[model samples]
Target: MKIAIHQMNSGIDPAVNRAAMDIAIRSASNQGAHFYFAPEMSLLLDRNRERGRIHIQHESTNRHIAALCDTAREAHIWVHVGSVPVLSEDGSGRFANRTLLIDPAGQIVARYDKMHLFDVDLATGESWRESNAYAGGTHPVLAQSPLGPLGLTICYDMRFPDLYSRLAKAGARAFAMPAAFTVPTGKAHWHVLLRARAIESAAFVIAAAQSGGHEDGRETYGHSLVIDPWGEILLDMGDGEGLGFVEINLSRVDEVRAQVPVHLNRRVIPPLD
Candidate 1:
């Protein structure tokens, strides 16, 4: 299947971001891509810590999601909208970073809330506590795709190998890690971590990333990549804003698994007594 990954520089305005995404998707569709993916924070990027505290109802409604679904239907392709901030249910001033999966017919098939929160102090004197502004998701999500079973995760979840391991054990053949990774950490760990996850799980890894500077003046790592089961990079977008795509053979999953057969090499040992 041919898949396209978009690297976008989103800002505080949803209209601008949506327009940019539309152009990218149209271009990919014109190129005959069967599936397309956008990076995290695809809708809006509010760097103002104060502005982040406000939770809006319209943001969580299905309107924006419907628009992406319409795009998918018109293009007749599977579309992953990365992550968008939605209002939390309890009427509290909290939000959820959620991912929407639109099928070829423009129907939402699955939704995955980001399970990991990015809370850290950067070396450049920038600190972020995601838990303060967004509610954390408790469950792991896996969706059925035309290619096979796909594991869903966002930004910080990429750092947790166990999550991917569990998904692999549950029969996930592909993994999606959509991220708006910080420039500092992304430059150091992005490719290595993504490649490691693909190698360890022996699954295809599709990473759609945020690129360039945002409205908040924060820079993001923009190298979107697709790695095959054998850990070979199929497509790399480099350090800029654009669309990256490649044709992936889903059958390669079984081929690679037969070679190593690591999944069957598990040895259970007794714990300390």
Candidate 2:
């Protein structure tokens, strides 16, 4: 299926981001794309926790999500609202970095919360304590789609191999890794880790990324990538805010798995002291 990946530099405004998404969805649909995708925090990218909290909406009433759903129905195309910040499930005032998959009918087919939070102290003197404002998800989800069984993850989840391995073993043929990766880590590990995930799982890896500087003083390394099962980088939207399109061939998944037999080559290891 044809997929459109959007690389954006979103800020604190949901309206602005949704407007950008609207244009991308229509243009992508015109390009014969069956699905449209965006990066994590496509609606909000502020560093201020309280401001984000004030602006974030509950899942039932998020205007950004409503707009995207409407666009999906109108365009008759599927969309992965890469992810949006929402009120935490426990009513703790924190938020959930959640991804939603919408069908052409504008119905939400699946939702996955980001399992890993970006709590790190970068060598570049940049620090983040994502857990302060967001709660991590407890479960991994694989959503069924026309293309294949798609494994959903957001941002920091890409750094964990076990998550992807579990999903692939559960019959996922493709993985979506929507991210607003910080500049330092993105430059050091983004491509390598994504390629490794695709190679290890023998599945397609589609990562929609946020690019450039934001009003919150955060800079994301934008290189929205689409890697084939063979670990070939099919498309890379190199450090720019724009829309990228690629038609993924599902047959390649079977072809590569047959060749690699990744799931069958398992050897259990014991915990070390």
Candidate 3:
């Protein structure tokens, strides 16, 4: 299947980001891509909670998201919106880093809230407390796509293999790991971790990432990658912001699984007795 990945350097403005996505979606559809993938926080990437709160709205009322859905419908292409920050239904006043999968008909088919929040104090003197502003989701999300069943995850959730394993075992042959990674950690762990996830799960890993510096004065590692079940890199958009297209073979999932059979061999390990 041909898929388009958008590597973005999103800013604090949701409208601006939506415009970028609109153009990319049309371009991808024109190029005959079956799906268009975008990075996490594709709508807005503001660190200033006070300043960003105004743009963050309930999904029902978020104009930017609605616009993207309309664009997806017009383009007649499936869209994997890596993620967006939206008001949670829990009434906790915190947002959810949510991923929305829009079908070719422009209807939302699946939604996955990021399960793991990034709350780290990096050695680079950059500190992040995602849990402070966003509530983590409790369940794994697996959605059906033209490419097959896809496991949905965002950013920090990629660090937790159990989530991937659960989805893979539940019949997911592809994974979407959208991220806006800090430069330091991204440099150190990005490629290796993604490759590991693909190899272990024996599934395709499509990671659309935020790249370069942002309006919030933060820099992101932009090496968006598409890895095969054999841990081979198919396409790597290195630190550039734009659209990239690649064709993925669904048969490769079966080919790799037949050879290694990790799913068949997997056994639950009990905690220390």
Candidate 4:
């Protein structure tokens, strides 16, 4: 099925982001896309810790989330919202960076909160303290969809291979690694990391990314991508801020796995101990 990977440069305004997404959804649906995959933080991209602290709301009550779900239902297509910043269930006043799987009926069938919090202090003097504002999720989600089984992951989670392997073993045929990757790290590791994940797991990888400069003065590396199971890049949206589409071939998952058999070749560390 055709999947539209929507790359966006969302700012602090939820309304503007939603409007852009709405247009993309309609355009993708018109082009016969079965699914729409939006970049992480598709609703808003505010780097001001103080502002973001006040901006997040519970998913059930968040109008931005409701609006996106409505768009999915109206378009009659599945949508993988890379994530939404929401109130954590613990009620610690911290939010969760959560990914939701909205079916064609606009019902949320699965949700994956990002487990890894980005807490890096960059050499360029850029520092992020995601843990201060958001709580990390413990569980991994491998969701079953009409198109295929998808292993859901957020930006920082892409750096971990064990999660992808676990999802692959759980019968996931495709992986979603939506991200709002910073320009520096993205230019250095994005493609290689994604390709490695696909090659190791023998699963298709679809990554929708946030692009361009945002209201917070933070620049993100776009290059939204789709990679085959064989690690070949099938599509790259480049640095532009727009929605792009690609055809997902599930058969390649099996074909590449059969050829490499990395899944079966994994050896036990201490004689299966």
Which candidate wins on lDDT? 3
Pick by lDDT: 1 or 4, better one: 4
Q: Which rank order by lDDT, best down to worst?
A: 3, 2, 4, 1
All models: lDDT? 0.85, 0.91, 0.95, 0.90
Clashing pairs in 1: none
Please list the residue runs of candidate 1 whose C-alpha ends up more than 4 Å from where it truly belongs after superposition.
52-62, 268-273
Count of clashes, each model? 0, 0, 0, 0
Angstrom error at residue 27, model 4: 1.0
Candidate 2 backbone collisions, by pair: none
lDDT by residue for model 1 over 1-273, one digit each (tens)? 888999888888776788888778778888999888998889877867576444234343646566777888887888889988888674666788888888989888988888889999988998998888788888888899976999989989999988998899889999988899998898899999999999888899999998887788898988898999899999889788888778989999999999988788855657899
**TM-score, prediction 1:** 0.94
Worst 10 residues of 4 by lDDT: 264-273
Tens digits of per-residue lDDT, candidate 2, 1-273, equal 888999999988888888999999999999999999999999888998777777887898887788899999999999998899888778787789999999999999999989888888888999889898788999999999987899999989988999998999889999999999888898899999999999999999999999999988889999999999999999999987999889899899889988988788877779998
Task: Using TM-score as the measure, name the better of candidate 2 and candidate 3.
Answer: 3
TM-score of each: 0.94, 0.97, 0.99, 0.97
The alpha-carbon deviation from the true structure for residue 35 of candidate 3, after best TM-score superposition, in angstroms, is: 0.4
Misplaced by over 4 Å in model 4 are 271-273
Please report, as a residue range, the 10-residue window in candidate 3 with the lowest summed lDDT: 120-129
